[model samples]
Target: MRGMTNTLTIGERVAWYRRRRGMSQDVLAGLVGRTVDWLSKVENDRIELDRLSVIKNLADALDVALGDLIAEPSLMEWVADSGTKTIPRLSAALMDYRLITPVSSPSPIAEMPSLVSLAQEVDELWQAYQASRFGYVTTLLPETLSRCQTAVEAYDSDDQVQARRLLAFTYQLAATQMTKIGEVELAWIAADRGLAAARITGDPVAIGSLLRSVAHALLAAGRFREAMQLIQDTASYLDPHLSDPSPELLAVHGTLFLTGSMAAARANDTDTTRTFLKAADESAQRIGQDANHVWTAFGPTNVAIHRVATAGELGNVQVAMDLGPRIDTSALPMERRVRHALEVARAYSSWNRTDDALSTLLAAERIGPEQVRYHFLSRQLVLTWIKRQKGRPSSTLADLAHRLKVLD
Candidate 1:
């Protein structure tokens, strides 16, 4: 049944679960405030279930866990791809007693890492993540978390504040990486921890940057409204500082709007999406060029990339196809480049350009194998192509599916 469920599209999964619940299409449609015709089309995959809120509604009516409908990857699958104990160790690091409890005295332990050394480690982790080296990042994250926590505990005065800033950045990295791998709950916890650490540092730039992580976590968890609200409020708070903003502030602020645009698109709020994108574009224009300050990837080119993504999310396949393929993302991080390619592939698949979609996904896989394999969109699209094939799929398609483990 697990394998069967995985092989089914989301709409097919809904139909399967409805049958298991002994409910008719009419009955399920009524439960979800829709017509029987609408339900029939949904079950037939004639309609796309792209909105999270709608998906959540369907899951609620079906009385199944959200993941049961989404076919989220299992713990064993993640471990198989990411080496043994990666998820559990990261979870353990988040739950460490030392991090959670206040220490009265400095215990006998190895000397605390210097602030410079710790900062370098944090930067390295960010670099690994941006390169889509998910396995390596996960392997190194638990120890980095512990080391940063130790630095926070050992430093004093101004140094303590700096250590806290680094700790916040580390947590933000964990949160973002967890989201990419579909660990939404763990991502939420890490985002919250990063926000807490940023608060202690009293650095508006740090706090604002971590807020983007929090927003991403919320977006991953399907809390689209909460995510957008957080972004709006943070933007308002940071507006006064933009008169003569630091590069870090500009990048963080622009990235926040970009995230809000995505959340808006996911919620099917086209007006808000446009508004957020406009603000982000204006911010980027002020910055004048592509840059990765604060690891926000906030710049003109990045804004253009988000435009392609939001267009795809909003179901404007033409717009995505027009904008996505033309953008040269070589200057951006490998993670961002791969993500844009995935969006472009989605556009191609939507337009029924399956060969082009397959080729695009193959190219992205070559660039960021971990990103493509673990990403829900890539896996789903591959499964869909396989299901649509009348006989055997093409060799390259089959190999791609095998590598993604979607055929499992």
Candidate 2:
């Protein structure tokens, strides 16, 4: 009991100094002179920590009273009040009603599902991670992944195409989460299956959507032209007259992923970009512009997040950042939230804002090790920008190359 108590106490102490310093794991590691990987292992209870001297150094660095390091309830408990605080926005039709909308559910958890319910099993998995329930999260992934796999297989045999499409989407969700948590190979395998199902089911939106992610995977490997080509193919494949897709489908394809082609356009035709944008907006309007499914139902906010960074390629960073948060992620079904978070991370990183870049990546990373792919994306942009800024090779860029075990 005492050992358990000590572990809790020490964890609390570690978490406190880290936060008080306003230091990310990487920054703290640099200060106290430890690798970020080691820092992560220590803080996450994956290692036996024995570096009180490091704490003293951190105390001096962050300008905190050293005594505060030993404060109780563990530092993790105060994260909400710590750096992740939500700054409430003023009301406007452009904002999420939830952002401006009063909290009608007195207890936030009132809407939450039990950890075992299928309807919200994906959320439960994410919740486990949010609560620092790493072991629980790990234990649950196989079950969730397996259950989703079984569902996909059953759909394969069943006559219901929509059920198959939904299950295939579920598989894609599981794969993307797995990728964020550092499950790259597994994620690729699952994603391939999901893509196959989308193809077999003839969901054009799903096909284009998978192609979009395929482009991301390619982009991360620095296969820029390949990624561009895939986007081109995807854009070529779309048929405006096609119907039955949710509003979110239009947003993702005609807007979100379509921006990739715009990025590679490089002054070919501003008029074409405008035309594509109009098509996306028109496609979204067909669905009433409601911000459901994480405001991805082709609403203004989702459109902003979708267009912002790519627009930045054409000098629209101010508009992108200003309009980004208005995206009502809360309205999204939980399965989609994880995916959106990864994209949000990418959007922020592309603007040369390292702090926002890291924050966005960490939001996805906090969820698990399988998300290395996103780290690749963010670090690529960040490293490139940093190198260009220095007029010398960035050591930080070199550091990420080492992490990726790739030499560029």
- For candidate 2, lDDT tens digit of each residue in 1-408? 111231233334566567755678888778778788877766654443222234445555566533333221111111322232111110111132332247743223223222234436665555444433333444445445444434543433444454455545544554544434333344455566567767877877666666665655553233445656676677778655355665556656655444453434223334555565666666556655545441234454444444543454444446656655455666544433444554555556545565675566556544532333323343343333343353654575555434433334
- Which one wins on TM-score? 1
lDDT comparing candidate 1 with the true structure = 0.85
Number of clashing residue pairs in every model? Answer: 0, 16
With a 3 Å backbone cut-off (N, CA, C), the pairs that clash in candidate 1 are none
Candidate 2: misplaced stretches above 4 Å? 1-141, 151-163, 178-187, 235-252, 255-276, 293-297, 313-408
Clashes of 1: 0
lDDT of each: 0.85, 0.47
Q: TM-score per candidate, in order?
A: 0.93, 0.45
Q: Give the per-residue Cα lDDT of candidate 1 at 301.
A: 91
RMSD to the native, candidate 1?
A: 2.4
Worst 10 residues of 1 by lDDT: 73-82
RMSD from true fold, candidate 2: 18.0
